[model samples]
Target chain A: MDLLPQLTQYAFSGLSTGAIYALIGLGFAIIYNSTGIINFAQGEFVMLGGVLTHFFLMVLKFPLVVSMAVAILVATAIGVAFERLTIRPLKRPTPLSMVIITIGGSIFIRGVAMLIWGKDTHSLPPFSGNEPLVIAGATVMPQHLWIFGLTLLVIAANKYFFYYTISGKAMRACSYNRTAASLVGIDVRRMVFLSFAISSAMGAMAGIIIAPLTMTAYDVGVMLGLKGFCAAIIGGMSSGFGTVLGGLLLGLLESLGAGLISSGYKDAIAFIILLLILFIRPQGLFSKAQTERV
Target chain B: MKRFVFSCSLFVLILTCSALCGASQPIKIGALFSVTGPPSFLGEPERNAAQMVADSINKSGGIKGRQVQLISYDTGGDATKAVQLANRLIKDDKVVAIIGPSTTGETMAVMPVVEKAGVPLISCAAGRKITEPVNRWVFKTAQNDNLAVAKIYEYLQKKKLNRVALLTVSDGFGSSGREQLKAQAATHGISVLYDETYGPKDTDMTAQLTKIRGTQAQALICWGTNPGPAVVARNAKQLGLKMPLFMSHGVSSKKFIELAGDAAEGVMLPSGKVIVADVLPDSDPQKKWLMAFVKEYQKLHKVEGDHFGGHAWDAMMLLKGALEKGDDLPATIAANLEKSRAFHGIGGSFTYTPVDHAGLAKDAFVLVEVKNRDWVLVK
Candidate 1:
């Protein structure tokens, strides 16, 4: 059999899933860069967005757009609140403690979600049409286009915010030197909280956008979180653009692996790439090599 | 000291009052289902079906004036959690009998607890080992993987598909199916052309399918839940392999259709009778009740009922019928179930004996094909 068409199909599938991973990974990058603490509950924020939206739209019979807006706003508020309560308390504490705290926070959120939502998988209406668009012998869902376009828009907006906005520069200064930024009268704490809000919103937005394709459930957050974390690490954890690239690469690799090789080992391909990257570069694709100052 | 004594007395009084109120209450049955994990697709439906059955029986004045109360716990598809849930249900909830810890892994995990507590436990999913070495307290409403294998073998023999390739998940369900298929294929003189296995959440099977393609196997038999069968369907189509594809009943879901798209069409599987409720003859013994159940379930849930839901309905109804027949709770229910014969159920006519806990025969399943992304009778 010809491999070109197969390869193309794999690429299309990869790109579709990659778009979602990039959005989630970008959320991870934002939190990591700002606070230097990985927000493990990022995926739960996404789940909360999709689930709340589903509840409002499907159960409460609210208008779809209204529900979507409410879900994003609510999820973002939750993110900010979580940081204020959990992460803020551990600001002066050890990094390991903060990491463990975030993990615990993730589990707590997931547990609460289970109790509230009753552990049912739910999906929202696709933002675009449901028809598959066949391009050059490869067929992809129209929703895939929506996800990819949304990912690009989010990335552009994020770039603009970080490079142009005053708060963004303050946030970047805090990331560079928290003590110095605090000395300069930059509200480092507020920046940290803002980072969480932005990251959580990104995650929630990813969930809302991709829920139509992958569906959403309480437990789905774990897998999404893990994949997004992998994407962040692979792309150079501090770089937003690198995170997106890494996510797309990882998604493409997994899909192509499934298409060309054994589908069963599709997930395995991600780790394998991870291992190879760590062995070869250690500093990640876009991360600068650090030298210890004497 | 007088105040402390008065507080203690009040606490005791409240406890006694609550205990007395609970003692005069309905017969409670605890159900542990994997309602929040990978298996939620199956467990959630089973829970709903169990609740539906309980509601129906209660609406009819329940079993001989005692209401059947179902207490459910989410196992999260973890074996350890299944045991924990089972203990909590038995101890805290004080349920007479437990209806499920759905999958075989979870059932086996909690089997010891049920056996030790001497409580009757009926599982909804199949793993033959659960009942085989004989745990008197442990029974199942669903047929074993071996029976499904036997049914598939019977069809393969009829279709003259002598050469077969196996693609299964490397888990309890897949391993059980693989072993059964291997032994049965040998007995039926069917050649084992190729065999491949994959992890549970795998989304591709091209490599295995390619190996099977080389073998020229007349049929490809896939065993796993959800995406396993979907991956097989998609990969098989991509490779242009025209062999007849057969799957284990685990993949009998709308999720498979949604995942596999048009590639799922023409895939054959040995499905439980409940899947084709409309195709059953009007004169069939359980037709009216089954149809009513389907209508009610669809009306309430807004989704088509699956074999999992049907099995739960049958199990709960059987238990209800047994409870209604006798005064004693556990003993009478067990005896009534043992003596039951040709009881018309959504899964077809069931006959339970002390030895056979499943209460259904191989004939309860009919071979079905995916036609236009929906299950259709093979005939």
Candidate 2:
């Protein structure tokens, strides 16, 4: 009944939702870093993950874990196809053209998804049962723990991959200086494709994982993607840690605002506060010591 | 020139002869429903219901031996398209009356067009604004939101649950219901202790629920369509917020139950009698009509007669009853429809007065509880 318990509940819920946004923000970050093009279809990949899993689980009668894995793979394949079919073979493509193409790609994906799944909302069974774990009167769902555990694990894996692995080094090098990396005999094109593949899988996994907590529908991607992009912008787009912070900040602000102020003005108040916070460090909440300005 | 004049005179004579014979023109009804969009779930069944009713009417030799023709256009949940369709139905088809435009947004959009054209429009949307101004030619079959609020408040008063928390979606349906909920609560001797809202597309509602849990409220009322309300149900369950949860009729569908799964158990909402048609007592006036509708609709679509379809059935029946009582002229039909009181149809028993174009009574809603993923009548 105390203020502490209510605050804890809001903060915990916010962080859990923020973790999903962080995964989506990372998807944006990876695609942006490698190609300098915002893959507007990031949210659609998440939708595809959730919807395809539902299709596999309910219609095809596949086991849940297998269906989830297959869903992730399918989304990843679509990412490869998207990059290869739309942007790869372009000759002297303009920046405006690339932007339009990605936007068009997102719409196309949504249209196709509608035909396949209709406009109905779907959900996945929770990894654990529905009961929440209560701590000193605060509550958290089992799915939240799943999200936090998996997101932290993925972030750690990504950090290790980028710092130590040859492919990750090549990806980082490509982002740093594309032409120079290409001159040094790195397959810059391959790195770009790899980034798309990885980010697409991540987005889809986030969709599948968060869907148990949140209902998934054909048209949910647009709002989710827009919020994730906001998180990416507020967290330095270049830093993984900053992206997580940005996602957490956005989620917490929204939750706290909705709880304390008028729920109707939740988004408005949060965005105003976001604008104020960004006024201090326009670069973002966190900035890498040395960053090439895009 | 002489031959041309003779041909014209012959055509005029034949037209006059057919007009005298009384089998010349079929009674045309224009229907606009969102058959393929986000609100398509509402429109598809409505379209089916209208077509089924017209077919049966024509098979029974229609009113005064004239065939009944149903002309429907899918609005696809777009307000612009609904307006365009309303114009076409009025100016082109020359229908005596019009039914539907499915959702609240579309019905509100087409109201001006139908009112200006002087055709009786029976809208299937739940927004109170649809008929609040009492457009002379406009009426609605769907129960007004205030009635649903009344239904909930009536239950609250009976249970002596005086204080409640309110969570509404920040959309048209939710906002209107929010106003009505607040306005109607005081009359029922209830106080809204906490009022909250969430985005229509918001994925989490726990924080708001957590705040409501801290309030001295006896129950929570969530006003939203599917997905958001479903998430709230799950969130409330996970947070162990055991206070009774009441949802708006916006989520009166199997979709919400499916989305919420086990979490939907014990959730209550005020819904049309269509969902519990089979369970109604034989002594009830609407049971026979509701069952007939259920049989006919299921025979055609293989699905149970739902709330949306029930709205269409009521409109069609109202128009038929009106046409039988009055002439086919638009004004006469409008007058007849207004005179229609204590009329039994699937949605509810409608009683229209000059001031109230929103025709259904508070009895239109039945308090239903979710049990094992199906609606069970509570009262």
Candidate 3:
């Protein structure tokens, strides 16, 4: 194997994994921007997506597309219910308190999922086929293409929603200044609710697309959620294209490091880069530093 | 207040009466299994099988007309938790003997606790270190990992595949297997071209496999539990790596086939004969026992029996035999276990001496392959 093809293989696999992180990072960024709180339960939504789709397809014998849609919809519903049940009831919710609540919700959801689905991992069939396409001595799965294309489409739609739609504009306003946004007659609570809905749906979609390659289980969310959080931190939680770039960079570094260095240090490479970015560029690689944080 | 005092006195009197009258107390035994965490696949079946054995013993009128009482705890695959639970079982439960602490790491963690307490433990984990140094109180039923590696290497040698790549998980089972693979490579006339490790929770192994693809290795041997090895299989297929793939006994179950999907096809491994019990000839001494256990376990759990459950069955049955032959005291049971010879069990026939705690030989393992999503004994 020549160095070039090997590098190409690394980059190709990295980009697909990066796309998953980007999806999850985008979810974290959305909820953070809207409610000024990091929802740790964001990962559970991703787990729900894959597990529910698996249940629908394998157990219920539903078609792939219908199973995916129902899974995403149910996850979004759970997101909304989570907000109504856990988040909206707080009388004086501090940022730390809300973060802790999300962590609790994450554990609760994970436990319930474990009870419903056994500890064994479940795999989803690849959307296209199992055959790999070779380009310039590098092999790529059809699922990777699906991941790349879907991630791009998602980012573009997210951009349109946040910039062009009125509700999305109002959510941004809440992120900027909640009191001011409420004073201007925008229903801030609705924006917060909407943010949860959008993020959970996005997270589930990401889980579904990546399930074929990574295999899905109840506990996979912990590592993946932390990695997405790293991506969000690296991208400065921009809720835009910044997080996408952050994920791509993290994935590539991890792959190349594993290939060139020792595979044992693969996970360490991600954390090292995360710590370096936090120390050097806390605002993230792609986001502009904000003058004030709400 | 007067009525409450009278009732308390009455309760104490009844307790004393029952204690005095109950001469034939049940024999208490403790078990520790990782029933719910990452390694639950190994632990769940093991727990079920152990419980099944205990129930059957009690049903048939337990050791010396004393009913057997099994107290099982779930360690969740955590070594620290295993140690804590071991203390609770020994000090609080007052169990004469202990079984399990499912994985090698947990088994190793609890070994000192059992040794200090003078309790005999028959672990289900396959790591060689569990019984290698021959702790006074510890024995295991699973075949040593060196035997599994030797079985694999012999097959590889027969195929003339001299050079191989190794990918292992960096946990107890894997690190132990990696050590055995490295140690026994020379005598088997095989050389390792590349060696790499991935975390137990890692989702991808393409990077590691890609590095192996660059090597002159003719085959890749992966040693790890489910999901990790499954990912390696998928990654190898995605990379179109045209080399034979071999796996450790950690993945001798159907769950591995389901997790890896199509990638599991043509994957070969070394496994306990319990996995291929149905195909074994009648002349095989262990075949009848294996078939009976497979049927009984499936009837109870409604699932196919694998090597993991077989390990627990061996441990419990070994303990039962000792209890039936000797006094119910831990010391006597330990002595009885040591005196055992040519005792047939699921993993293999055991012949425990004072020197060798893990009594099975290299022939305990048979080479098996995954074909069409089922295990086929390689001829």
Candidate 4:
């Protein structure tokens, strides 16, 4: 393995992980854009997707595709319920309070997950198989391809949802001005509900695709969630390609940094990049600086 | 005045009687385990094994006609909590000896407290530092990371695989194993080609493994607990790396095999003899004891006895041996444990001494490879 091959392998692996980060970051962006609250429990939805799929497939003996679909649906259901129970019921909602609530919800869901699934790490079989596909002396598992393909599919779906669909446009309206959107009969509350459902479903799908490679557990959400949040921040909380790019960049930097610099500082490199981005480009690299009128 | 003097004499007599009765009371042994946290796989089995041993001992007419009482606390794998719990066990519970704190970090944190309190602590964690420098009051049942390193090196020596890549977790267990791997490389006629680390919560190690693939190393040794090393094994397999992948004793459990699935095939690790007890010849001293413990643990806990539980079983039985021979005093138990010689129990035949508290040697571990998702003793 020469330097080029090694670097190529690193980039390939990084892109796979970056795709996951992008998916998770999109979840954070969706909720943030609509509700103005960071869904800290967004990561839990990812965990729930993987674990629930494992449960459905391994425990309940459901087929793989059925398990995946049900897992995503369950996670989306929970997301909608979360919006209804926590976000919508806030008599006096503040950004800090809502964020704290999401954090609390994340911990609660993790605890319940532990009790139900267990603390042991569980792995799902790869969707196709575990065969290696080589390209230019770099090898990747079939699951990596699944990650790339599904990430692109979800990003496309997300674009279509937010741009072409009426509900998505209404959701965008809610993001801009919930009061005005509601005044115009857009049903701001329903738009908020749709955003949670979409983001959580997307997040669950991300978790399912990656579970084969990374494995899943009740507490896996913490780090993945934090990393996804970082992705969202790097993308300046964009709901589309910006977040995807942010995720890819993060994954590539993490993988490359671990390979070239030192594996010991792999996570450190990620956090350092995050800090730099926050310092230099407060509004993120892609998103335009906004001027809001009161 | 005569009646008052008589009553005082009677009170003295009663106090002496109560003190004499206290001698027949059950011996209290304290245990600290991370029985419900991330390391619960280690701590849960240990706690269960200790309880099982205590119960069986009591069933067999007690330890020298006095019942044994095991007082266990869940440390939650936290070092600070372990120290606080250790203090409670020593000061409030007044146990004769302590069995665990499950993990190395917790055991190390609780070591100074036990030393100050003069309670003998037989830890279940495997970090060499737990028993290094020969702390008089601190001992461990898990084989030293140095011994595991030696076992791997010995195998490498036989296979003529000198150059190796080291990937260790940046935590207490991995760092300790990494240090030993580096320090003992020369002795075993091996050289390290690449040394890398990953966080405990890291999801992937393809980048690290890919770099190792680029190196001139003939073999790879990953030191970490479940999930992390499992991920490494999968990544290596994905890259089609033909080099033999070695793992430290940290992941010597069936859980690792299950987690890694097919990727676990061909992965080798140094493990306590407990996991391979049935395959051991009857001539082996620890076989009978190991078999009996496995059966008893399964019956009691409904789970197979792995290396971690075997550590607790060893700790509890070693303490029992000391208690049966000596009186119920911390000093007596410590002295008795120090005198332990060729005690054939699970985790190997432990021979404790005044100087060497870890007791087990390199032979405490046997190199085993995963074949068809089962541990096969490596020839």
List, for all models, the DockQ compared with the true complex: 0.15, 0.64, 0.77, 0.69
Give lDDT tens digits, candidate 1, residues A83-138.
88988876466668888888898999999988888655565676766555777756
Best by DockQ: 3
The sequence of per-residue lDDT tens digits that candidate 1 reaches over residues B1-379 is 9999999999999999987886457889889888877687768888999999899888987777778899999998999999998999988988878888778889988989988887778788777787777667777778777778888888889888899988889888788899999988888879888777877644335556655665668988999876557767866775567889999988776767766667788998987777777887787777777788778889889987777887778778777766767864565666776777788877667787878777777877778888987888886
lDDT of 2 by residue, B1-379 (tens): 9999999999999999887887458989999999898788789899999999999999998987788889999999999989998899999889889999898888878878877878899988888788878889989998888889999999999999999999999988889999999999888999999988899988888889989999999999999988899999999998888799999988888888989999999999999887788888888788989899988888889877788898998999999999999679988999999998888888888889999887777888899999988989996
User: Residue A106's C-alpha lDDT in candidate 3?
Assistant: 96
Question: What is the two-chain DockQ of model 4?
Answer: 0.69
Chain B TM-score for candidate 4: 0.92
- Candidate 4 per-residue lDDT, tens place, A1-294, comes to 568888899999998889889889989998888878889999999999999999999999999999999999999998889888988898988899999999999999899999988888899999888778998788888888888888788778877877898888888888788788899999877877888898888889888988998899999999999899888889988888888899999999999999999998888877887899899986787877652200
Docking class of 2: medium
- Model 1, runs deviating above 4 Å: A60-70, A91-93, A124-139, A256-261, A275-280, A291-294, B1-98, B112-120, B149-171, B178-248, B251-269, B292-306, B316-337, B367-376
Question: Residue A174 deviation, candidate 3, in Å?
Answer: 0.9
lDDT of 2 by residue, A159-206 (tens): 887778998888888878889999999998899899989989999998
Could you tell me how far off, in angstroms, the CA of residue B283 lies in candidate 4 after the best superposition? 1.5
Root mean square deviation (Cα) for candidate 1: 5.0
lDDT of 4 by residue, B155-224 (tens): 9999899999999999877888899999999999999999999999898899999999888999999999
Q: Candidate 4 at residue B12, lDDT?
A: 99
Which order, best to worst by lDDT?
A: 3, 4, 2, 1
Chain B TM-score (each prediction, in order)? 0.91, 0.91, 0.93, 0.92
Model 2's alpha-carbon lDDT is: 0.87
